[model samples]
Every structure is written in C-alpha cells, then in structure tokens.
Target: MLPNYFNTKPLADYMRHDLNIPADREAGSLSAGRVGRIAALAAASSAAYAATGHLLALLALLPAPAPAEEGDEDRRTFWTDLRRASGASALLPANLRIGVVAALDGHGAGLATRLLGAFGGMSTDQRVATALLVGEHLTNGDDFPGPASTTGELWLRDVELTAWQIIHHHRRPPTRQAREQFREAWNRL
Candidate 1:
C-alpha cells in the first residue's frame, strides 16, 4: 500500500532522480553497492510517483513534504503539468504510450521498453513525465495549459505521430505511409 501522506512532487523528484541513473558512469568495486543504491532510490521514486499520480497532487498527497516550496515552485509546476500531459498520452495503448515516453529519453524505443521492463512499472511521477514529454512534443508550436487537468489523448497521438515524422523526416510520403500503417496495425491490439 502507498504511504498515507504520499503525493506527486516528491514522487516527481524521485522519478527524475531515478532516470538520472548514471548508467554510463563506471561502477567500481562498489558496483553491487552502487547498483543497489541506485535501484533503491529509483524504486522509492517510482513508488512515490506511483502513489502521487502527478507532482502537484503529490504536494498534497505526501503526509508532509519538505514544508518549503524549495523556491522553485514554478519549475515544479511545469514538470507536474508535463507529467499529467505525458501520462495522459500513455493511457492510449500500453505499447505506444510507453514507447513514446521511452523514445523521448534520447535513446531508441527498444531502450525505453527495456528500461520499463527492468523497472517493472513506472511510478506515477515517472508516468507523468513520460506523458508530458510526449504531450509537449506533439503539441509543437502550441501553448500547453497550466495547473488543471488536460487530456493525455492528444499528447499520446502527438508523440507517436511526431516520432514517426522525426524518423521519416527525410523520406518520401510512401515510406512514411508504410511506417504509419505498420504502427497503426501494431497499435490496433
């Protein structure tokens, strides 16, 4: 069960912290120790995110957050909105929703899938961040709203479509069409 006071902001912090895992850094003789620490932190963050749903909500969820806005309330708010938007996208289809969030990490979709599998499930904060990325990317050249809840559907579609566009930006319409068709077929269940 989740902590009675858990909420979204700390959860988001945990998500960011987890994703910041220095997979590339050298794990010395303390490799096991390091991995354990990273995993624990990641798991905690994941759990927090899972508990809170979004950071703004997390602020209210956690029994008692730091008691200080940390002087970056605005930044936190932006991230919270991002998470909500991206998470909404993830609601589309398991594969595509996860795929878009993972893909935005600057690595390939395969890596994203692997990470998700390795982590098992995303914390609520993590989900929100993923949704936000997809949502922001898809809403290209448009203004995203503040605070209140918005639909993740638009974000989900936009992320998938944008990813397709990026991959086939240089190709002709036929190639793009084939890829889109394949994606649609795959997403159909």
Candidate 2:
C-alpha cells in the first residue's frame, strides 16, 4: 500500500501549489518558462537534463511532503533502495562526482527545479552556489518520497548521475576556481 503522505496532485494542481512553479501558467507551458530554463541546459548533458526534468515532473505528481526532522539519518538513506535496485554506484559521490546527498525528501526535486529558475532571483555567482546546494541535497541520501514505481526505480541511477549536471550547467562558471568561490560564498549566505 502507498503511504498517505505521497504527492498525488495532477500536474495542473502541482503547478498551482508548487512554491517555485508559477500557478498561472499552464502545465504544458512549464517547459517554456521556469522549467524551460533547465531544459535549455540539455544541450550539454542531454541525458542528465532529460532524466532530471522527467524526475521532477514525476515528483510533482506526489503530494506535499512533511517537514524532515533535524539530522534524520533515515532521511539521508532515503535513496538506498532505488540506488541498489538500479545498480547505480554505491559510492554516492561517485554517482554524482561532486557531492552526494535532503528534509528535501519528496520535495527536493521540485525545489531543485525552482532553485534553477533564476536561483531564487539571485546573482549569477549566487546561482552556482544554489546548484551546489541542490547537488548536495539531491545526493544526500533521502529515500524516495513514497513507494517506488518500476520506471522510477529503473531510471533512478540516471537521475542520480545527471540531475546535478543539469543544474550545474545552467550557470556554469568561467573556471573551476571561480565555481569554488561561488560555493564558498553560498555557504556564507
């Protein structure tokens, strides 16, 4: 049986209620506005961008999530089953190659999408920091929001591999050192 807390809204409802998504916009039009921004990054990491965007759309179907408890270990290990079932890298960082790891639970994917939408209206440098934060939250370890689907499990690995890549490419810095500085500044923020 599915958990009572899972997100169960239709795309239109999700678009309306989602904090990051625009309520007035039609669901199909999401790809043109805020969500479109992420899609544009598909030029480089097509697989990653496509998978992450798909994952976000799937996640949007879920119900709103409960607040994560502080320092919740179960939350950190949330993606364990999906990771194993997909035969993805056991080393979280290896799957991400940057960081692994979210209170984010069911809401993480959607939040990440919104964060990419001009990164909460932040400056360019601040946006990179937002991506780094998204990578950390997504890879951090929380399991799936509710029960997993066969398709969800199957693509879990690909989602893990490229979600961050899509976010990273959105506001790519001129150099590695510059990106690092953004991370540092974001931490300060």
- Tens digit per residue, CA lDDT, model 2, 1-189: 111222222232333333255545455755456576434432333333344455455343322232346455553454443233223333232333222122022223433443233223454444344333334444445643422333343333344443555455333224545768989999998
What candidate 1 gets wrong by more than 4 Å, as runs, is 1-72, 80-150, 171-189
Error of 2 at 168 (Å): 3.0
Global lDDT scores for all candidate models: 0.39, 0.38
TM-scores, each model vs. reference? 0.21, 0.23
C-alpha positional error of residue 163 in candidate 2 after TM-score superposition, expressed in Å: 1.3
Q: Model 2 — which ten-residue stretch has the worst lDDT?
A: 97-106
Error of 2 at 33 (Å): 26
| TM-score of candidate 1 against the unseen true structure | 0.21
